[model samples]
Target: MKFTLAKPRIFFKVSRFLFPFIIVMGVLCFGTGLYTALVTSPPDYQQGDAMRIMYIHVPASWMALCVYSLLAILSLFILVWRHPLAEILAISAAPIGALFTLLSLVTGSLWGKPMWGTYWVWDARLTSVLVLLFLYVGYWALYKAYAHPAQGIRAASLLALIGAINLPIIKGSVNWWNTLHQPASITKLSTPSIHPSMLFPLGLMTAAYGFYFLLLLILRARTEFNKRKCLVQENFS
Candidate 1:
């Protein structure tokens, strides 16, 4: 089937409208979550004020994993179907995922220093997450290394697929080993084990981050598309 510009143009037009709305909602949710986390929510009995960092740390860590997982799926789409949007999405997602991973590590360390009496630990979860960050960097590097843009996308997609093998490892690390990281709290099938007050802000923050990711992804993809267009024009000129 022949590809048409009209489809992408129509989709992007709708996305342009939706993106701003999502951004507004994300900002509002983030503001509300921050307020609740800092003031309305009671401090943890064990961790005290330090527990407040969960509002930021948990969401970042979640987004780190979530975004990489998304990249992996998009990479598979690019590899199998040669979807132009898939490659664009995967490329756009990598840097944002890296940022989230970095935030997770930093905030985790800050929260750790007070509780674990050390800033870093070679625990299963933390180590696996570190590997995830490296994977993002690796994919980004591969994408930029090749002279041909198609070759770069193909190479990066392969890296993304291979790196995804670690996702299960990251998720199961706490279960597989005696790790410093705690087991799943809110994701339990039996019950959400967190308090409602804490759960509300945590959920809000997660939603905020999701919207933020989408907003950034759209922006980056549009930038990339424009760059590619300019390069094509330059080649013809």
Candidate 2:
């Protein structure tokens, strides 16, 4: 598996075979999750129907953090191990991470309007998450700003590593501060605070998001690899 991932051609070939399975599973999870989140799961006694937004908001927030963590690791590979595929994967994933961060913010605002009586707040958690979005955008912009791809990737990867400081802040903000955002219900060391009835759909939606991110990452990495191959050929020709 390590050998396969190190070689772009091998990785691309393996991903091609796995792509259809990812699509099928993602669709099934999304279909069933929407059914349960929108139809079956009981609404919060307090927040009412608006709480359904948690299905999207919570999972998107998770993925946004997960992807950036992945980016930070890939950056280490690019900077230290100098892995060839790491750069491609890093660039491919940055935009997807940004999209997930953006989705989380938008859905959280929509949910907040009814629950908090406002669409936006400068709470610690919200502000940290917003900083996360800016980090994602900054990494992407830094990658594109250079004339050489290698230079750009190294600069962007450094940014990714530095930005990792915010992940813990985002995760711990609710705990550390008197914030509007509720403390984590599902990720506690003890048993999750959430009810099993709602947890099922949240799990399903999280799986859906994971599969979708994998699908997009593989596709984008292949495209990046091919573009680099073409450039190399042109230089040699």
Candidate 3:
């Protein structure tokens, strides 16, 4: 079938085919990652057992940013193309992004308490992440505030667009400010500073989180699409 963003039903069918496969992959990745992270991988020289928290914290942080980036891109699509699926996808993604953002914050705090001796700090990285969480919530609120679909999405899309500015700030915060948060390890242009043993599990967990997000995104988008279709049918009837 020809894949097109304009056709939600076609997208739904494709997602249905991919769903079970994604679930299987996600489960395998999660199981293997957990075992490797908690059992096989050596603890950090500095942090010891506390370093295991990075397994969850880093992936959640990555996913939080990734999902919000997706949201911003979808918002742009909604504004420029005005595709029906764009609206469904944007609305579907907001809560998931928020969940990831919250997870990132919580896990970061858990990890930070041991190293930084504080649970929370108002530094650049942390503060920008908090702002990202608020942007996700704000987008959802704005989308729901309007009775008209077009108006609501337009307002929400604009917020998503404006909030896109924070993405860079969140990414660059550690470099820009003297935050307690460590600098990037895996994302550096040079070879990653992370040891191979730690990087292995981290990679697996990142894949697991990614697949899980895909499964959730497709399911949520499908549900939103069906709900809208039913509403339309009812109105016509």
lDDT of 3 by residue, 1-237 (tens): 233745887888888898999999999999999999999999999889899999998999899999989989989888988878888988888899899999999999988887899999898899999999999999989988999877999999999999999999999999888987889998879999999999999999999999999989998998888888899999999
Local lDDT at 137 for model 2: 98
Q: What is the lDDT of residue 224 in candidate 3?
A: 88
- What C-alpha root-mean-square deviation, in Å, does candidate 2 show against the real structure? 1.5
Displacement of residue 207 (Cα, Å) in model 3 is 0.4
TM-score for each prediction? 0.95, 0.97, 0.96
Question: For candidate 2, what is the lDDT?
Answer: 0.94
The C-alpha local distance difference test score for the whole of candidate 1 amounts to 0.89
| Local error of candidate 1 at residue 207 (angstroms) | 1.0
Encode model 1's per-residue lDDT on 1-237: one tens digit a residue: 554643456658878989879989989988998888889999888889899998999999989999999999989888988988777778888999999999999999999999999999999999999999999999999999999979998999999999999999988998889998898887656787788989998988899899999999989989987887899999999
Question: How many steric clashes between backbone atoms does each model show?
Answer: 0, 0, 0
Off by over 4 Å in 2: 1-4
Report every candidate's CA lDDT: 0.89, 0.94, 0.91
Worst 10 residues of 2 by lDDT: 1-10
Give model 3's TM-score versus the native structure.
0.96
